[model samples]
Target: MSGESAPRATVGSESLERAFGGTAACNACGARVAEYRVVALFLHETAAIRAYCARCYPAAADGDYHAGGDGLRLDYAAFAARFGAPGPPPPPTTPVDRMLAALVADPALRLLAPGSEAVARRRRRVPYPVRVGFALDGATSEARMSVAPDGRMTDLAGDPAACDRVRALLAGI
Candidate 1:
């Protein structure tokens, strides 16, 4: 590696330090270093080395670079070819969809179709039903929701944890 262009140490040195015990953040995304996270170190034509989190590294790979030397070179096309194109974005979520996703986030919970007879039968066998039914409506503030086995429409608007998880997931999208 060129002493001036590349670091005397190998790539990911900071990430390694942070992973072991030190604290470091990705220069690109500002994400804290973590053991499971992948960080890429890029040496630019200006002789500046930058660190990026996995999500931001792909974009960085496309930047301009100098000729290959010191075992460091940025090949945008090759890098993109090595990693296939990203998939299409997820479909947008409506309020009812968010509500349903939150309701079913629990492993034991199930979303059942409305007026399903199996829901009634399952309710009869257990004190508490594990299923929930919902009707999606773009006009409503929240989906019309009902607990299984009882089949009574109720509101989960007061559920903070469920609402939080749903909001977090939506925000990530």
Candidate 2:
């Protein structure tokens, strides 16, 4: 690991559990993690932070150093503006947040807001599908995708091309 130390206001295990319950998902691999390290990334005129499980931290750090993992490349200023200094770095958003943000940004996809019956129904399925809300000209009016436990988009109810696009977006995250 690099010589860098943890950021200020870094929360301990008790705070983490209070903020995110017993399990928090790894920001990179989407695995449910009970233990993790939080790092604030400063790069290319941007700053943002994330919590990474042991397995994915190395790769995420490597990617940050190498300027890989493009898309909404977390400008530090923007992050600071959105989440001002104070308490623990805003807990990394859940995998669902990442997924919804990606889907909403794509013009070809019309993201569904949570709490709808459609979204709730899909969430009930075995293995659970990430209810995408909707996609324009998609295979189904109600868009939902099944994601592997690892966070990969395994299948989607939409045009193959749109699905591919969504998958690519998710992969970048």
Candidate 3:
């Protein structure tokens, strides 16, 4: 989405002032953002601050607003092609993959490059498929890995630590 904040949307002056200091996630993509625009609040109590990047706040049709490198703006297809798209359902996973996934998920894991898109995209593709299992909220989650030509993740079993982390970083949607 566009890096610029939204233009005037007719929010109250007080509301805008409050938003200046607070932070909120983008309603369109869930990326953490500063409260720049207040839409509506629940039960007429609080301001339901719904701020989005310039691109997402305006042209986005659904929630999946994709921004480009400059964070300028983009349509869905272009976003998907440049940045890896979310994967579809896959088959079962293996024990090794599961462990790796957990390590990947760990906040302490230092495997992936820090704030490196080239590394993130390049490393996503595995020469061979890997699988992993995980537990969340007392439920079992599995993750599978698939490689692609652009070195992006083609498919993954959910909750796989590496898959989840990288996906979250890359997409942020």
Candidate 4:
């Protein structure tokens, strides 16, 4: 799958009818198809979701059939990359960066004090607000995690145990 060949994401014979309502070109075949696979990864989200007709679909490269679902598993390599990346995401430039990296690396994310969960400025007398949230890849409304000048961490609504854990993870940042 790597010998100077890479499949570009595209759909042949695409049209408005197929995209919105009528016939859309199938991903595997150029024929105008209306139905897309429940798990198809279309080149374009606005277009049909990389659906194939009854004939083209149902074929699995790994030949593994999933129960109660039709999505052919993509991202085998992506899965490998995620797990294969040694250590953590990388060192951060800011307190929030360290906090985020730690959180993402920690598979056992949960509330330490009673709920769920960075940074430096051990010298600064003023506390600064750091926003945290669930969404990683996109922008989200973040809950505040403040850092007291003397190195006191406040996660969410000032959960002490959670702060301690987060602090341990983000030490020396």
Best by lDDT: 2
Residues 109-167 of candidate 2 have per-residue lDDT tens digits of: 43332312223234465344554433445343344576543445565776566566666
Candidate 3 has its poorest 10 consecutive residues by lDDT at 40-49
In model 1, the clashing pairs are none
Put down candidate 3 lDDT per residue, 10-112, tens digits, no spaces. Answer: 3332333234346555544556666433322111111122345444554322212222111222232332343322222222333222323333333333221
Better of 1 and 3 by lDDT: 3
Worst 10 residues of 2 by lDDT: 63-72
Predicted candidate 1 versus true structure: per-residue lDDT over 15-129, tens digit per residue: 3223324434554345655422222222111122334445644443433111111111233233223332112222344333333333433222212221122223333643222
Estimate TM-scores for all models.
Answer: 0.21, 0.35, 0.23, 0.26
What's model 2's overall lDDT? 0.43
> In candidate 4, what residue range of length 10 has the lowest lDDT sum?
110-119
Q: Score residue 171 of candidate 1 by CA lDDT.
A: 54
Q: List the residue pairs that clash in candidate 4.
A: 18-23, 18-24, 42-50, 111-115, 111-116
Better of 3 and 4 by TM-score: 4
Order of the predicted models by TM-score, top scorer first: 2, 4, 3, 1
How good is model 1 by TM-score?
0.21
Q: List CA RMSD, all candidates.
A: 19.5, 14.9, 15.5, 16.6
